[model samples]
Target: MTSPRMIQIASGKGGVGKTWLSVTLAEALAAMHRDVLLFDGDLGLANVDVHLGLVPTLDLGSVIAGRARIEEAITTYEIPSVSGAAGGVKFDVLAGKSGSGVLSALTRTEIAGIARALSRLSERYAHVVIDLAAGLDQSVMALCTPDSTTLVVVTDEPTSLTDAYAFIKLLTLQDAEADIRVIVNFANDREHAWRTHAALTNACKTFLGIAPPLAGFVPRDNLVRDAIRRQTPILFRHPQAKASEAVRKLARDLLVPLPKSTPGPVLRRGA
Candidate 1:
C-alpha cells in the first residue's frame, strides 16, 4: 500500500485563515474524487469542526486520553454534490478539543502516540491535511516530519512576515531538507502576492540558505468571510468565488496523483 501525502498547514500567527484554507483545500481535493483525511492539529483550539459547523463529541484529545481509539475519534462529512456529480464526496475529519492549554499539557509520549496513529491512518487516504497550531512552540514544532509537506501561510502585515520567517528558520534548523511551501493569503492582487512571496523567499535564501517555492496565493475575498460565518467552506458554498477558485487550482497544482496501491493488506475504517 502507498502512504498518504501529509500536508501540514501552519501559520506563524493566529487568525491568518490557516484552518479555513485547510478545510477548503480538503474539500477541493475530495471533489476531485481523491480520498482525503483532515486532521485538526490545532489541538486545544481546534476550529475545523466549528468551520464545518459540526459538533464532534470525540476529538484527538479523546484518543490521547485513552478514552477512545483513533478510529472512534474520526468523524465523517458528506460533501454535497458539486460539478453535477451524482454522489457526494466522503472525507474523514479528526477534530480537536477546545480547552485552555489542554493540548499543551500533553506529554511527549502522548504526542508521539498521536503522530504514530496519524501515520497509520494516512495509509488509507490519498492525502492527509493537518491544520497545525500557530507559532514556534514546542507543540507546533513537534509535528514537523521529513515526510510531511509544511505550508507557511503569511499575510501582508510586517508582523506576519517576521513571525513567518522565524517559524521557517526554526523548522529548517530541525530538518534542513524538509519539504516546505509558501502560500500568501489575503493578497490584494497577483503583484501583491509576488512581492510578499519574494520578500519571504529572499530572506530564507539569504539567511537560512533555503527557499521554499510559492505554491499559490489566496485573494482577500468577502465570500470567505461569509462562508466562515455560515459554517460552510467557500469551495462548497461558492465555487465561483475568487478565493475558492484559487484554492481549487492550488490543490490541483500541489497534490500529485495517488500511486497505484500494491497488492498488500490495508485497513480502512468506516469505508
Candidate 2:
C-alpha cells in the first residue's frame, strides 16, 4: 500500500479554526472509510483533546520521553450514530501533552526522531492529519517536508492576513516547492473568501513569487461554536450547518483520487 499523505494544518494566528479544520477533515475522511491518523502537532500547548472533550492518557510527550510508543498513546474517536448502531466511523488520534511548555525546548534531534517515527507510523494509514502550532516558528517548520501538504488557515483580520503571509514566506524559504494551500475561515460569503484569497495570492506572487491555490472557505457559522462548546464535531452534530457543509465539500475537494494500480493518500494545507 502507498504511504499515508501527511497534511499539516497550520495558521498564521491562533483562533482561526486551524485545529477545528484538522480534526473535522480527519472525521470526514474516516466517515468515507479512509483510515486516518489525526496527530496533535502543537507541542507547547495541545488543544485537540480539549476541543474534542477527550482526556488522553498519553500524548506526543510520552513518545518523545520514551515512556510510550507512538501507537500506545493513540486515542480512538468514534462518530456516534443517531440510532446507536454497531457500526460507525472511527479514527485514531495522537494527542499532545497539555501545558507542556517543555516540549518547545526539545532539541532538533528529538524532534527529528519524532518526525521519523511519525513518518513510519503513517504508512499504516491513508491520511495523517497534523494540527501544527500557530505561527511560522521552528515547531511548525519541523513537520514540513517535500512530501507534506501545508494548509494555511486565515481570516479577514489584518493581523491574521499578515501572519499568514509570513508563514507562507517562511515555507518558501525552507522549501520553495512546498505544496501550500489556503482556507479562508470566517468569511462572510464566497465573494469575501475569494477576495481574501486573491489579496494574499497577489501579494505572494509580487513579493515571494509563490502562489498557493485557494483550496476553499468556511463561512461564518454559530454551529461551529456550539459544537466546540459541546466538544463534538460540527460535522457530526450539525451536518446540515453551513460551516459543516462547507467543510465536507472542502474535504471532498482535497481528497485526490488514486489510480487503481498505485493508490495514494490525500493531504491538504492552508495559507
Candidate 3:
C-alpha cells in the first residue's frame, strides 16, 4: 500500500493557533473524502482532546504504558450534521493524555518507538496530520522526519518570529533539505500575512541559505475563538466563517499533486 502523506504542524511558541489549524486542516481534508488521522504529537502537554472536548478512555499514554496497543488509542470523531443535511465529515484522532506528564518523562528509546508506530500507522490512511508540541525540545524534534512536510506556524509577534527562526534553523542543521513550509496565523489580511512570511523567509534565506515557501495563511476571526470555547471545529460550527474559508482554501492548496517520494525512516534520537 502507498504510504500516507505525513503533514506535521509545528510552531516555535505556543498560542499561535497551531492546534486549531491542525484540527481544522484535518477536518477539511476529511470533508474532501480523504482518510485522515489527527495525531496529537504533543506528548508532554497534549490538548488536542481538550480542543475537541473528547474524553477518551485510552490515549497515547496508554500505548506508552503498554496498557493498550497504538491502534487502541485512536478515537473517531464525527461532526453532526445540521438540519438533517448530509452526514458531516468523519476522521480519526489519536488523543494524548493532558495534565499527566508520564508520556513526557519517557526515554529517548520509548519516544522513537512511538515515532515508528506512527509511521506504521500511516499505511492505513491517506494523510496523517501530527500536531507537534510547541518549542524545539528533543522529543519534539525527534518526531520530525525529513520525508514529511513540516508546516511551521507563526504570527506577527517578534517573539514568534524569533522562535520560528530558531526552530527552522535547527531543522536545517539536522537536514538542510527538509521539506519545511510556513503558515501565517491570525493575520490581519493577505498582505499582512505575506509580510509576516517575508520576514521569516528573508531571515532564513540570509542566514540558512533556504527560504521555506508559504503554504497559506489564516486571517483573524472571532468565530475561531467561539469554536474553541465550545470545543468544536470552526468548519463545523461556522462553515461560512472567514477563518473556515481560509482553512478550506489552504486544504485545497495542499491537495494539489506533488512529486511522489519514498518516506525516510523515522528519526531516532535520545530524549
Candidate 4:
C-alpha cells in the first residue's frame, strides 16, 4: 500500500511569505529526485502561478466548473535540485479558483472524492505540498483533512504573532491530534525567529496543553521583494539570497530521513 501525500503551508497573518516558502520547498524536494505537487489551497488569494511567473492554463475553478479536468488544470514547472550543480524534475501545480465557483465545486462528497484522488496521485509522486488559506474555512478543511505535515508560517510583528496564536487555536479545535510544524518567516535573525516560534509553541502548550514543534525559520531578505517585482520566485531569480538558502536547508531537513517512519496511527474516514 502507498501513503498519502499532504503538507499544508499557512500563516496566522498575511504577507509573511507562507506561499513563497511553500513553493520553494516543493521545488527543493523535487530537486532531491522526489516527485512533488504544489496545490494552491487558498481560494481568497490564489497566486502560486504569480510566484512562478506562469499564468496557469487552467485552475481548480475551471475543473470544478466542468470546464477542465483535474489533469488538464495541472501545470508543470522545473525546480532546481538540492545539489545546485544538478537540475531537478518537474512539479504539477494545482492552482485554486478565484471566483464564486470555488464553493460550488467542493461539496462534502467532492471533498471525499478529492481526498481519494490525492492519494492515488501521492502513490506516484514523492511529496505533495498544499498552500492553505490564512484561516479556517470550507476549502481549508477539505484540503487539510488529509494533511500529514503542517507548516504554520509567521513573522515577528504583533499582528502576525496574534494571528499565529489564533490559527493554532482553531487547529486545536479542528485537528487536535494533528502534527503542527511552525515556521517563522521574515525574521531579523535567528533570535527574532526563535521568539516568534517560542511564543506560538508556548501558547499551544498553555492553551492546548501541547508544545508544537518548530519546523524552522526563513530570514528577511530584500531580494524576495525584488524577485516578486520581477514576477519570479526568489529560488529561481536569486538562488543565493538568505531566504533561498534557508528554504534549501529546510528542504533537506524535511526530506532527509529522521529516526524512522513509524506509521502514524490511522483514522478511518466515514462516508
Give the alpha-carbon lDDT of every model: 0.81, 0.82, 0.86, 0.72
- Residue-level lDDT of model 4, residues 1-271, one tens digit each, is 1333567787767788888888888876776677889988776677788777677778877776789777788888865433443244678898876444444346756765765666666666778898887765555666666347777888778788778787777776778766677788878887777777788767777877876666677888899888777655567668889988888877776754444333222212220
TM-score (all chains, Cα) for each model: 0.89, 0.90, 0.92, 0.84
Q: Candidate 3 on 148-251: residue-level lDDT in tens?
A: 88889999999999999999999889887788878999999878888899999899989998878787889999999998998877887899999999889878
By TM-score: ranked, best first: 3, 2, 1, 4
Off by over 4 Å in 3: 1-4, 82-86, 259-271
Candidate 2 backbone overlaps, count = 6
Instruction: Report the C-alpha displacement of residue 206, candidate 2, in angstroms.
Output: 0.5
- Which candidate model has the greater lDDT, 1 or 4? 1
**Tens digit of per-residue lDDT, candidate 2, span 104-143:** 8886677777888889999899889999999766777787
Q: How many Å off is the CA of 237 in candidate 1?
A: 1.1
lDDT of 3 at 249: 80
Best by lDDT: 3
TM-score of predicted model 4?
0.84
Measured with C-alpha atoms, the lDDT of residue 172 in candidate 1 is 83
Give the alpha carbon lDDT tens digit for every residue of 1-271 in model 1: 1333888999889888899999998998888888899998876587888888778889888887789999999899876544434337678899888654587777666776788888888989889999999888777887776677788899988888888999999988888766778889999988788788889879988998877777788999999999889876677778799999989878877654433432111112221
Model 4 stretches with alpha carbons more than 4 Å out: 1-4, 79-89, 98-112, 260-271
